[model samples]
Each structure stands twice: as structure tokens, then as C-alpha cells.
Target: MRNPLADKVVNIKPSGIRKFFDVVSEMQDAISLGVGEPDFDTPWHIRDEGIYSLEKGRTFYTSNAGLKDLKIEICNYLNRSQGIDYHYNNEVIVTVGGSEAIDIALRAMIDGGEEVLIPQPSYVSYEPCTILANAVPVIIELKAENEFRLMPEELLEAITEKTKILILPFPNNPTGAIMEREDLEKIAKIVIEKDLFVISDEIYAELTYKEKHISIASLPGMKERTILINGFSKAYAMTGWRLGYACGPKEIMEQMIKIHQFAIMCAPTTSQYAAVEALKNGDADVAQMREAYNQRRRYLLHSFKEMGVECFEPFGAFYVFPSIKEFGMTSEEFANRFLQEEKVAVVPGTAFGDCGEGFLRISYAYSLENLKVAIGRLKNFVDKLRKEQGR
Candidate 1:
């Protein structure tokens, strides 16, 4: 019997993060920092709104672009917080999550064989989404010296006549590297010079530490060329709610909305209601969670230094990328052995991209007590390895 799956579907690998998660799941007493979700529960008020909506029988599909109220709230939220604005009536399309928004945007923008430039050690979705959309994902390896930030020179070097989009995964996953206004301006100049479109994933926009996140779309002349992706998952502690949105020029948004409409019908209606309340009243919860994660970030950095693990200091997001090169093991080998010896699960850096080899991503989303325990186990594991190798 012939397998009926499309060639593109068969060619892509499963998400590297999920593969390790499944392994960790079977291990009893494993402390996992591999999954990128907040430890905090969704705030009570947001949950209440969802319950309130369900009780009022708001279960049917929403308008394909989502409810006007939610879109309006999203527009206001982005404008006020990130200084990026979109027309609620024409520019925003709410989707199942940022994941869906990425998929829809790629499908809408890329024709077959078009090229999408993606910076490495980024979230895993960008490359696969581009491939699934029949676009070539041109991977640009970001350097650790620049704190894994995408350099304009690197970006310019990757551009070709076939290039149609650039996936800006800043305030990045795994590395936690963010591009500030100056950093973005360099890239923006190239975008304008080269006539490239941008899919800016700002899912971690609220979690930046050193400086407030600057949306690429907020730069002069870039709004029309950028698709901004954000959601309540990280900011509002609403990962399970599966709500996200994409905003861009009306023409691009209209095309994305078509893909979303045929594929998802609409994002969950209850989630849309909850998202409205989140956008309106969830600022305090976001601030509280950011402070908590920051504390954990500080603790983890201190512990890693004490343990002699060389790491790039992360200025954003809740994850730390530490080089395990001195340990004389591949990222996967270190991760597997660390799990076996210490029962603590951190993601192998290679799971993010090829450039992530010799590093590990430790998420600070756990409680302080758990982090202390994990660090203690990590200390022991490092010591044992040192003793065995006579280091």
C-alpha cells in the first residue's frame, strides 16, 4: 500500500524538543526544564473569563479572523507595550497559537522554491514551517560572541534573488538573545535594500530583562514589510489556552486569514474571550511572572558559574544557554548522561539547531526550590565526571 502523505510532510523531522521530552517523561523522579512553559498557572481572572464565556454558551466558531473585541484588545496591547500598531479591522488575525500564525504567514507569503532566511539556535518551528510551505529555509548561524544575535552582515551574506522572507526569532528561544533598536536598524536597512519581508516572532516580547523589547515592525518603513507574531502563552501564563495572533499589512493579513480560515476555521472561541480579558487585565500577572523568572535566572547563572559551566548570560526569555564543551561530550550525550546521573532534564542545545551543539538550554521556569535541587544534582554530576576523567 502506498503511503499517502505529501513529500514535504514526510521529509520533516519531529520537533527535537518533543523527542527528548518523551524520553524524560518515562523517567521516574526526573526534574524537567526541557519544556518551555511557565510554571505558573493562568491567572484566576483570565480563567474566570473563559468559564464565564462557556456558561453563556459562547462555544460556536468565531469569525475566521477572530472576534473584533479580541483583535481590538490585541492592537491596543501591542501599541501600548511594544509600540507596534495594527489596524484591528484589517491587519490582525487571531490563530490557535503563535505556531499557527507562523504556519499561516509562511503559507501565505512563500511560493514554492522561494527562500526564507532563518537565524539558527532559534525556535525549531521556523525552518520546518518554511519547508512545509515549500520554501527553502536558509539557515544563518548566529555567533555566541554576539550573544547569538543575528548580525546584519550575516543576514546580508545569506540574501539571494530567491529570498522572500526573513524569520526574526529575536528575544530568542534557547539563547534568549534580543535585538534592540540599534541592532534592528542595521537589519532593517538590509531588509529595505534587499526588499525582503519579515516574520518577526515576538512571543517573548514581555520577558526581556535588560531593555524593553523593540518590535521590528515599529521601525520606520518596516510595518508594511513585517508580520508581527505574539500571544498570551508566555506573557499571560496561558499556554494551554492556545491563543495567538499575527499582524501585518492588510494585503498579507488577508492572505494569511484565508489560510487560517480554511485550515483552522477559527481559533478557539472560549480562548478568544479569555484572551480579551488577558490583554485588558493581565499586565500585573506578566510583571509578577517576569520578576519570578528573573530571580530564577540570576540563581541559575550563579550556580552555573560556581559549577564552572561556561554560559552566555541571557538578557531575555527564561532559558540559559550554557556551553558544555569542557565536559568532552556532544550536547545530546551530555543531556542523556546528565539525565541518567542526576535525573534532571535539560534540553540538548543541538535540539534547537546545528549551531547549538556543545551547549545546553536550561529553562528557569521552575520554582526556586526545584532549581536549587537541580543545581545540586548538576554539581554532583560535574564533579563525578571530573573525577572520572581526572580533570
Candidate 2:
């Protein structure tokens, strides 16, 4: 018998972040700070809308794109929040989640063998999706000294004639980095000069602590060249609802919609309805959750400082990347030993990218009580290691 499998699928690696999560799932008394998910319940208003949709027997497929109302609301939400305007008819597409949007957008754009510029220490999906799209992945390693922001020089260094798209994962996962307007202005100039396109993943846009998120699409001439992807999962605690949307140039979006139509038909009907309510009336709930996350972010930073851990302050998202280089152990070694001895599970930073070695990604999306306990365990582990080094 001949073995049958697509080599591309087999060659792609599974997500490294999930390795620790799978173990912690069944381990007794294990506390996990590895998953980057919001702990809050879906806002009641949004949930109630879903219930109402079901009661009304709205259990059918929306159009191949999405319900007109949801798309309109998405446009309105963008316009009011970011000063960008999109046409609901042609510029938006609802997806299963932001992950799906990432996948399909790559499929829509790549024609095989083109290079996609991906900055390192990002969400795990970008590289694999580019590979599955038959495009080459070019990684631009981000630096901690620059607060993990992508610099203009780095972008210029990575580009080649084959370079087609840049995946901008801001309010970045694992590292919790954000690219400000100034940073983006520099990048946009480079992108335009190079005739490159972008896929900007803004899933964590609403959770920033220091300043409002500035969409690159909102920049001059950028809206025509960027596929802006976002969803309700992080902001409204709607991950289970499985809803997200993409907005971009109509030509690109039309191709994305063609892919989505055959592959997915449409996003979940109930989720779409719920997301409409979220977009309209969920700002207060989002603000409340953001404040809670901000508090946790501050607590974790202070605890790391007092414990002598060298962690740069992260002003966005719910995770921190702290250096463990002084411990004389690889990230995987330290994280594994800490989990085994202290029963606290944190992700090795190398899970994000090779450049993340000698660091750990600790998420603060858990409750304050859980965080306090986990940090206490981390402090104990660090002190024990320092004593062993005779420091």
C-alpha cells in the first residue's frame, strides 16, 4: 500500500504554544499562564442577542459574505474608532475567526513562491499559513532593545523582488509589542516604496493599556494596500462564537470572499448576530475588561521587578516576555523545570520564534488571585536558581 499525505501539511509544524497547554490540561494542581485567551465571560448583551436570534429561528446561512447589518456595523465601528471608511458591500468579509481570515487572506494573495515578510515573536499561524499558501516565509527577528517594535531598517533589510506581503501582528502575542503611529509611518513608507502589501492582524487592538491602537489602514494610501483583520474574540470574550471579519481593497476582498464562499459558505449565523450587538453596544463591557487586564498587567510587571526578573514593560495585550538569560538555561529547560518543581506552567519564548530563546511568555489573562499565586511560585523558583549560581 502506498502512503498518501500532502507533503506540505506534513512538513508544517504544530503550534509550539500548545505543547505546554496540552500537558497542563491533565496535570493535577498545575497552574497555567500559557494560553493567550481572555478569562472574562462573553458580555451578557452579546450573548442575549445570540439567544434572541435562536429564538427567532434565524438558523440559516447568511449571504456568502455576511449579514448586511453586521458588515455595516463593522464599517461604522472602524470609521468611528480609527477614522477609516469601508464599503460594506465589497470591502468586508466575515470569517470563522481571525485565524481563518489569516489563512484565507494568504491563500487569496499568494501565487506560489512569493515571499511573505513575517516579523518574529508573533502569533504562530503566520508562518504555517504562508507555507500552505505555497509562499516562502521570511522572518524579521524583532529586538527587545527596540521594545520589540519593527524598525524601518529591518523591513528594508528583509525585502526582495519576490517579497509580496508583510504580516503585521501588532499588540503582538507572547511579546505584547505594539507598533505606534510613528513606527507605522516609517514602515508604510517602506512598504509603499517597495510596492508591498500587508495583512495587519489587530485581534488585540482593544486591549492596549498605554494608548489607542492606530490602524495602518488609516494611514494615507495604506487602506488600499492592507488587509485589516480583527474579531470579537479578545475584546468581547467571544472566542467560542467563532466570528471575525476582514476589510481591504475590493479586488483583494473579492478574491478572499470567493475563497470563503466555497470553503466556509459563511461564518456562524448566531455568532454574526451576536457580533452585531457587540459592535453596537459592547464598548462599555470592553472598557471594563480592558481595565481589569490593565490592572493584571501592572501587577505582573511589578512582581517581576521585585523578584529581580528582567522583563521589559509591555503596554499592550495580556502577556509579558521576560529574559531568563541570566539563569544559564535555555527557555525550554527553565520552563519545564519550573512547571515540574513549582507546578506553574509558562510558555518558553522560543515557541514564538528562535529569537525568543532565553525568555518566557507569561500570560496575565487569569484572575488576580491566580496570578498572585503563580508569581509567588515563580519568585521561589528564581531565588532557588540564583542561590545555586552562588549569586
Candidate 3:
């Protein structure tokens, strides 16, 4: 038989997070902090909305863009929360998930070999998506000193004539870093001057703890150049619903919808209806969950400090990136030994990018009880390492 796999598809690496998750699954008594999934179940009202939609025989496919009501709610939510005004009719498309939105946005924008600037230690999907889109994925390695936020100098340094889009993943996964309004204003100016577009993945937008989440699309001259991606997964704990949306200028949105139309037909109809409820009545639920996650975040930071482990305080999302560089082991080695010895599972920071080599990503989405148990184990593990090295 001939070699059937496209080299591009064959060569893209699988998710390192999922590989560890599979291992942890088979081991008895393992507590996993590898996945970024919210531990909360979908709020009852949102679930009821999906049930109601199904009972009402609303299983038919929506327009390629999505149900009119869901798109309207998405627009209203963005406008109300971030001062981002988008026309639902021409500027929005519901997607299977934010993952799909990311993929399709790249596909639509890249002609053949345009350079896509992706900040490091971001979600694992962006690099593979850019490769699949036949674009050059230029990774801009973010530094821990910058709170893992993309610096304007870094962006300016990576640009060239081929540079086309920037994948700005904020309230970031794994690192939990958030770019503030002033930081974004400085980058936006550079983007405009350089004539580049941005794919802003704000999937964890509502999980911000220290500051209100700001969308770059709401910035002057950015509404037209930014593709805003978000969904109900993190904030509303609707991960399994597999629903997300993208909003941008009409020109880009039209092409995105075109791809979505043929490729997906439409996002799940019931999920769209449920998401409308999420947007309309889910603010309280989001706030409640955010509070819980914040409490856990603080707990983790305190525990890390008490144990003398180095970790930056994360103010957004549910994950914390703790430096394991002092342990004299790579992130993967520390994580593996920790899991085997302590029965705890964490993702190596390098899963997101090579620059993440000396850190580990730990999610605090678990309950307070679970977090305490995990921290206890982590403390013990750190002690063992230090003692063995005669520290």
C-alpha cells in the first residue's frame, strides 16, 4: 500500500496533556491536575435549556452562522461585558468549540505560507492548527518575568514581511497569565503599524480574578482586525456542550462562515440554545464559579509558598505555572516522579512549548478538598527531592 498520510498531518505532535491523562487514568488513586477542564458541572438552568430545546423538536440544523437567538445573545454579552459591538448577522459564527474557531480562523486567513505569530506556553492547539493551515508557525517565547504575557518588543522582534496574524491567547491556559488593558493598548498600536491581524482566543475570559477581562477587539482600530474567540466552557462549566463562537469583521466572518458551513453544516443546535441561556442568565453562575476558582488559586499560591516551591501568583483562569527549575530536573521528569511517588498528575509546561521546559502546569479547578490533598502530596514530594539532593 502507498503511504496514505499527509506528512503535515502525520508530523504534528499529539497533545502531551492527553498522553499523561491516559496514564493517570489507569493508575489507581491518582489525582490529575493535567487537564484544564472545569470541575463544575454545567449549571442546571443551562442543562435544562438544552433539554427543553430537544423536547420542543428543535433538533434541526441552524443556519451556517448559528441560531439567530444565540448569535444575538453572544453579541449582547460581548457588548455588555467588553464594550465590543458586533453584528450577529455578518460578524458571528457558532463553532463546535473554541478549538474549531481557532482552526478555521487560521484556515481562512492563511493563503499558503503567511507567518502566524503564536505566543508560547499557550494552549496546545494553536501550533498544530497553524501547521495544518499551511502557514509558518513562528513561536514568540514569552518570559516568566512578564507574567507570560506577550510583550510588544517580542511581537515587533518576530515580525517580517510574511507575518500576518498573531494568536493572542490570554487569561491563558496552563500559565493563567492575562494581558491587561494598558498592555494590550501598546501591542495594538504595534499591530496597526505593522499591518497585521490577530486571533484573540479569550476562552477563559470570564475566569479573570484580579482585573476585568478586556477584549482587544474593543480597542480603537482593533474591532476590524481582531478575531475574538470565546465560549461557555470555562466560565459556565459547559465543556461537554462543545459550543463556542467567533466574531470579527464582516469580510473575515463571511469566509469563516463559509468554511464552517460546508465542513460542519452548523454547530450543535441544542448546544447553541443552551449557550443562549448561558449568556442570558449565566452571569451569576460564572461569578460564583470564578469565586470558587479564585479561592483555590489563592490556596495553591499559599501552599507553594509554604513549601518553598517557586510559583507566580496567577490572576486569571484556573491553572498555575510553578517553576520546577530549582529541582534540577526537567518539568517532565519532576512531573513523572511526582506522579509515581505521590499519586498526583500534573502537566509539564513544555507540553505547551519548548520554553516551558522548567515549569509545570497545575489546574485548581478541583474542589478545595482535592486541592488540599494534592498540595500535601506536592509538599511531601518536594521535601523528598530536597533531602535526596542534600539541600
Candidate 4:
């Protein structure tokens, strides 16, 4: 019998984050800081809305584009939250999650062998999704010195004639790097000059510590050329809901919706009703949660300082990437050793991208008590390594 798997699907690597998560699950006393999920429950009101919808027998499938009410709420939320305007009818698409939104957007826009510029240490899905879309994924290694923000020069250097899309993963996963307004302005200029489009994944938008998350779509000349992907998973603690949306040019959105129509039918009808509630009444809840995450974020930074571990301060997202290079171990080795020695699980930075070597991603999503214990273990691990190296 002949093997029948497509090589493209066969070649995709399983997510590295999940590999360690599976390992940690078997350890009885292990404390996991590896998963990027928020620890908070869905806000009571949002959950209540879902219950109300189900109780009212609103379980039917929504339109392929999702509920119009939800789309309107999404547009209003984006405009109110980010100063960007989008038409609910034509410019926005509701999908299974930000993940599906990403998949559809790439499928809609990418042609065979088109080049997509992806900055390293980003969300793990982008590269694989691009490959499945039949596009070539070109990784630009962002640096620790720039706080992992993509330099315009780097963008320019990577662009070739085949370049068609850029995946902007800011308030980045693992590293927690955020691109500021001015930083985006620089890259926006390059994108316009080069006639490139962008897929901006701002799923971590509301989790910024001291800064407001800036969307590249809000920049001049960008609204028409950017596909902005966001959802409730991060901000509203609705990961299980699997709801997200994409807003962008009508032409592109039409293509995305076509793919979504055949592929998804629509996002969950129950989830859409609940999301409308999230957008309408969940702002205060988001603020409260953000403040809580901010406290945890600061504590992690201070703890790293006290331990003398070298890591750049992260202002956005729920994870921090700390360098383990001083210990003279590969990230995987350090993480495995830490888990064995301390029963604390952290994702090796290589999980994000190859450039993430010598780093580890520690999520602050756990409670302060759990994090404190985890950090105590981590400090001990690092200190022992220090002693061994005489550093």
C-alpha cells in the first residue's frame, strides 16, 4: 500500500509549547508556566450571556459571516478601543478563533510561492499556516537589543519581488515585545513603499502593561492594506469559546469570508451572542483583569532582577522571555533540567522560532502564589548553575 499523506501536512512540526505541556501534566507536583493561556475565568457577564442565549434556544447556526449583531459590536469595539473604523457588513469576518481568522486570511491572500515576511519569536502557528497556504515563510530574526521589535531596515532587507504579505505579531508571544506607534510608523512607510500587505495579529492587545497596544491598521496608509486579527481568548479569558474576527479591506475580507463560508459555516452561534455581550459590557472586566496581569507582570520582572537572571523587561502580553545563555545550556536542556530539578515547567524559547535559542518563555498567567513558588524554584536552579560556572 502506498502512503497517502500530503508532504506539506506531513512536514508540519507539532507545537513545541504543547510538547512540554503534555510532559508537565504527568508530574504530580509540577508547576507549569509554559502555556500562554490566561488563568482567569471568563467574565461572569460574558458567561451569563452565553447561558442566556442557550436558555433562550438560540442554538441555531448563524450566517456564514456570523451574527450581524456580533459583527457590529466588533466594529464598534475596534473603533472605540483603537480609533480605527471598519464596516461591519463588508470589512469584517467572524471565524472560529483568531487562529481560523489567520488561516483564512492567508489562504485568501497568498498565491503559490508568494513570500510572507514573518518576524521570529512570534506565535508558532504563522509559519505553518503560511506553508499550508502554499506560500514561503521568510523569517526575520528580531533582536534582543531592539526589544524584539522589527526594524524597518530588516523588513526592507527581507523583501524580494515575491514578497506579498507580512505577519506582524507584536505584543509578541514568548518575548512579550510590543511595537509602539512610532515603531509602526517606520514599518508602515516601508510597507507602503514596497506595496506589501500585512496580517497584524493583535490577540494580546489588551494585555500591555504600561503602554496601549497600537495596531498597524491605525497608521496612515495601513487600514486598506492590513488584516487585523483579534479575539476574546486573551482579553476576556474566553479561550474555550474559540471566537475571533478579522477586519480589513472589503476585497480581501470577501475572499476570507468565502473560505470561511465553506470551511466553518460560521463561528459558534452561542459564542457570537456571548461575544456581543463581551464587547458591550466587558470593558470594566477587561480593565480589572489587565490591572491584575500588570501586577503579575511587574512581579516577574522584579523577581528576575533579584535572581540576577538576565531578561529584557516585557511590557506586553502575559509571558516573558528570559535568557538562559549564561548557564551554558541550550534552551531545551535548561528547561528540561529546570523541570526535573524544580518541577517547574517553562517553554524553551526555541518553541517560538529558532532565533529564540538561549531563552525561555515563562508565562505570568498563573496566580501570584504559584508564580512565587515557581520563581523560587527557578532562582534556585539559576543559582546552582551560577555556582557551577563560577559566574
Candidate 5:
């Protein structure tokens, strides 16, 4: 009998991040700094709201674009935090997490074989989603010297007539790099000149340390052309709830909503309720979580530096991508050995993209105590490797 899977589905590799995570799951006493998720619980008030909603039997499907009040809250949150304005009625559509928003945006924008430019060492979803949408993913590798930021020249070089969209995964995952206002201006110029639409994923917008996040949509003349993707996942410790939203021009968002309506009908009703509370009353919780993450970030960076690991400093998100080149092993080899021998689990950089080779992404989302323990074990492992090599 022949296999029944479609060619597109069959051709895609499973997520590289999940592959090792499955092995680590079976291990005993492994300290996993591999997963990129906040350690905090969802704030009490938000949880309370969800419980109340369930008690009130608000389990019915919301509008296909999500509840109006929730959209209004989202608009307020974005305007207050990121200085980006959107029409609640026409510009925003709540989806089942940022993943769905990404999928819908890509599907709505790209035709078969159109090129979507993606910066490398980004979140795992963009390229895969592009492929599933029948679009070609054109990867532009961000260099460590430039703090893993996408430069305008690089963006320009990657563009061709076939290029239809740029997926800007800044406030980036795994690398934790953020695009500030000046950097965004250069990109805005390119976007305007090329007339390319930007799908800006800013899920980590609330977690920046030294500098505030500047949304690409906030750049002059960019809002009309940029689709802003954000969620309650990273910022509010609500990953498991699966809530997210996309804001863009009405025409594009309408097309996205059409796809969403046919496929998903609506995001989870409970999640939307929880998300409304999250937006209205979660700022204090976000600030508290950000403080904790910042402290952990300092600890991990300091520990890595002391251990002689070369890494770029991450300004946003809760991950540190450090070069493992000195270990004289592929990232997979290093991560595997570290897990098996040291009982510490981390993701290899190659899991993100090809440019991520010779690096490993360590998430700082764990507690300070756990981070200290993991760092201590990592130090010992590095020393052991060096001694074995007689170096």
C-alpha cells in the first residue's frame, strides 16, 4: 500500500527543538534550559476571570474574529505599550496563539512559490509555516557581530522580484535580539522602497532589558504595510492557554479572517476571557516576571562569561545563544553529550536554522536556583572536556 500523506506534509522535517526534548523527557534529573517558556504562573486575577467565565457558562464560540471587548482591550494594550494603533473592529483578529496568527498571515499573503524573507536563528515556526503555505522561505543569516540583528543591506540583498513578504522575527526567539528604533528606520526605508509587507512577530516585546522594544509598525509609513503578531504567551506567562492576536490592514486581515473562519472558526472562548483580564490587569505581573528574568539573564550571562563561553549579549526574551565552536563538536554533539554526561538539556543552535550551527540556545526561564545548578554543572562539563583534551 502507498503512503497517504501529501507531498508537502511528508517533505517537512519534524521540529529539531522537539526531537531532543523528547529524549530529554525520558532522562532522570535532567535540568532542561532548552524550552523557551516563562516559569511564572498566570496571574491570579486572570485565572480568576477564566474560572468565572466557565462558571457563567461562557463556553460558547466567540465571534470568528474573537470577542469585541477582547479586541478593544488588545488595541488599548498595544497603543499604551508599543505606541501602535489599530482599529478593533477591522484591524485585529484573535487566533489560537501566535502560531496560528503566523500561519494565517503567511497563507493570506503568499501565493505558491512566492519568496518570504526570514532572518535566520529565528523562531522555528516561520520557515515551516512558509513551506506549508506553499511559499519559498529565503533565509538571511544575522551575524553575531551585529548582535544578531538584520541589517538593511542584508535585507536588501535577500530581496528579489519574487519576494512578497518579510517575516521580521525580532525581539527574537532563541537569540533574544531586539530591533530598536534606529534599526527599524533602516528596515522601514527598505520596506517602503521595495513595497514589501512585513509580518512582525513581537511576542517578546514586553521582555526587553536595557532598551524598550520598537515595533516595526510604529515606524513612519510602516503600520499600513506591517502585520503585527503578538500574544499572551511569553509576556503574560500564558503559553498553555494558546491565545494570540494579529493586527494589520483591513484588506489583509479580512483575508486572514476568512482563512481562520473556515479552518478554526474562533480561538478558544476561555482563553479569550483570560486574555482580556491579562490585558487589563497583567501589567504588574509582567513587570514582576520581567524583573526575575532580567536577574536570571544576568546570572546566566555572567556564568557563561566566567566559563569562557563566547556569546552575544541578549537584550530581549529569556534565551542566550552561545557559540559552542570552542568545544570542537557540532552543536548536536555538544548538546547530546552535555545531556547524557551532565544531565543538562539545552537546544542546539542548528534547531533554529542552518546559520545556527556551532551554537546552543539556553533559556533563562528557569528559577535562579535552577539556573545556578545548571550553570555549575555546565562549568564542570566544560572543564572535563578541556582536561580530556589535555588543553
Candidate 6:
């Protein structure tokens, strides 16, 4: 038989997070902090809307761009939340999820051999999607001292004649760092001068704990050059709904819509109707969930401090990147032993990127009760490691 696998697909690594997730799934006693999913159920009203849509027999496919009303709601939500204006008819396309938006945006924009700037310890999809799009993935290694935020100097240094798209994974995954407006202004100036485009994944925008989240597209001279991708997954706890949308200049969005039309046809019809409800009426529910996550986040940080673990304070998203460098073990080694000895599952930082080697990404999306139990196990594990090293 012939070797049928494409080299590009074959060479791509499977997600490291999923590997641990699968193992933890089978270990009935294990508790997992590896996956980035929210623990909250989709708010009842949103689910009720989906049920209503089905009861009305609204299961047919929407337009390739999406239901006209959902597109308008997406624009309205963006304008209401971030003050960015986009035309619903041309600038937006609903996608299967934010992951699909990321994929199609890269495919639509890159013809081949272009360089895509990706910051490390990011969501796992960017690098692989760039490769699949036939583009070069240039990684900008984010530093822990800067709280994992991408600095302007780093972005400037990564640009080249061939650099085309920059994937800004803020309110970042695995690291939970967010870029403030001042930080984004510097980057926006650089991007404008360099004449490069951006794919800003703001999926965790509403989950930000600091001041309100800002979209890079709202910055001067940026809206035309950036594709903003977000979805209901994090904010409304609608992960399983698998609905997301992308907004950009109509030129790029048209190409993306073309790809989405042929490939996905449309996002789930029931989910789209539910997301409309989520956008229009789910604010209080989101605020409540955000507060709960914030509480859990604080508890974990306090627990880490008492255990003498070094972790930077993350103001956005539900994960914490804690340094495990003092343990005299690789992140994988520490995580493996922790899982086996403590029966607690947390992701090795290197799962996101090589720069994540000395850290571990622990998600706080789980409940406070579960987190308390997990931290108790973590404290014992840390103390045991310190004693073994005679520290």
C-alpha cells in the first residue's frame, strides 16, 4: 500500500493538551485541569432559544455568511462591547467555531510561502493552521517577566519582507496574559508601518478580569488590516455549540466566506439562533460566571503562594502559568509524576510551545470546590519535591 499521508499533515504534532486529556479521561480517579473548557452549563435561556428554534423546525442551513440577524447581532455586540463598527452584510462570517475562523482566515489570505508571526505559549491551533495554509510559522517567544504579554520590540524584530499575517492570541491560552490598549497601540503602529495584517483571536475577551478588554481592531489604522475572531465558547459557556464568527475588511472576509461555504456550508443552525439570544440577553449570566471564575482564580493564586510556587498573576482568561523550574524536573516529568502520585492532571507548559518548558498551565475553569481539592494535592506534591531535594 502507498503511504497516503501528506508530509505536512504527518509532520504536524497532535495537540499535547489532548494527549493528557485522553489519559485523564480513562483514569477514573484523576482530576483534570488540562482542558481549557468552561465548567458552566450554557445559560438556560440560550439553551431554551435553541430548543425553541428546533421546535419551530428552523434546522435548515443559513446563508454561507450566516443568518442575517445573527451577523447583525455580532456587529452590534462588537460595537456595544468594543466600539468597533462593522457592516453585517460583508464584514462578518459565522464559523463552526473560532478555530475554523482562524483556519479559513489563514487559507484565504496566504497564497503560499508567506511568513505568519505567531507568539508562543498561545492557543495550539495557530502554528498548525499556518503550516496547513502553506505559510511559514515564525514564533515570537514571549517572556515570563513581561507576564507573557507580547512586547512591541518582539513584534518589530519578527517582521520581514515576507511577513504577511500576525496571529495575536491575546487573553492568551495556556498563559492567560492579556495585552492592554497601550501595548496594542504600539503594536498597531508597528503593524501599520510594516503594512502587515493580523488575525486577533479574542475568544476570551469577555472573560478578562482587569479593566474591560479592548479589541485591536478598534485602534486607529487597524480595523482594515485585522481580522477579529471570537465566539460564544468562553463568554457564554457555549463551547459545545461550536459557533464562532470572524470580522474583517469585506475583501478578506469574502474570501473566508468562500472557503467556509465550500468546506463547512454553515455553522450549526440551532447554535446560531441560540447565540443570538446569548448576545442580546446573556450579559448578566456572563458577568456572574466571570465573577465565579475570578474568585476561583484568586483562590488558586493564594494557594500557590502558600505553597511557595512561583506563578505570575494572570488578569485574563481562566488559566495560570506557574513556574515549576525549581523542581529539578522537566514540565512533562513533573506533570507525569504529579498525575501518577497525586492523581491530579495539569498540562505541561511545553504543550503550548517550547518556551513553556519551565511552567505548567493550570486551568481555573473548574469549580472552586474541585480547585480546593486539586490545590491540596498540589501543595503536598510540592512539599514532597522540596524535601527530596533537601530544600
Clash count per candidate: 0, 0, 0, 0, 0, 0
RMSD of each: 0.9, 0.7, 0.7, 0.8, 0.9, 0.6
lDDT of each: 0.92, 0.94, 0.93, 0.93, 0.93, 0.95
Best candidate according to lDDT: 6
lDDT of 5 by residue, 68-95 (tens): 9999999998899878889999999999
Model 3 lDDT per residue over 1-391, tens place? 9998899999988999998899999999999988888899999999999999999999998889999999999989999999988898999999999999999999999989899999999899999999999999999999999889899999999999999999999989889999999999999999999999999999999999999999999999999999999987888998899999999999999899888988899999999999989999999999999999999999899999999988887889999999999989998899999999999999999999999999999999898998899999998999999999999
Q: Which residues of candidate 4, in runs, are more than 4 Å off? A: none
Clashes of 4: 0
The regions of model 3 sitting more than 4 angstroms off are none
Residue range 140-247, candidate 4, lDDT tens digits: 999999999999999999999999999999889979999999999999999999999999999999989767888999998999999999999999999999999999
Model 2 alpha-carbon drift over 4 Å, by segment: none
Model 5, residue 218: what's the lDDT?
Answer: 88
Clashing pairs in 3: none
lDDT of 2 by residue, 207-295 (tens): 89889999999999899999999999898999899999999999999999989989999999999999999999999999999999999
**lDDT tens digits by residue: candidate 1, 6-95:** 888888878878877888899999888898999999999999999999999999988999999999999999889768778899999999
Model 5 ranges off by over 4 Å: none
- Regions of model 6 farther than 4 Å from truth: none
Candidate 2 has a TM-score of 0.99
Error of 5 at 264 (Å): 0.6
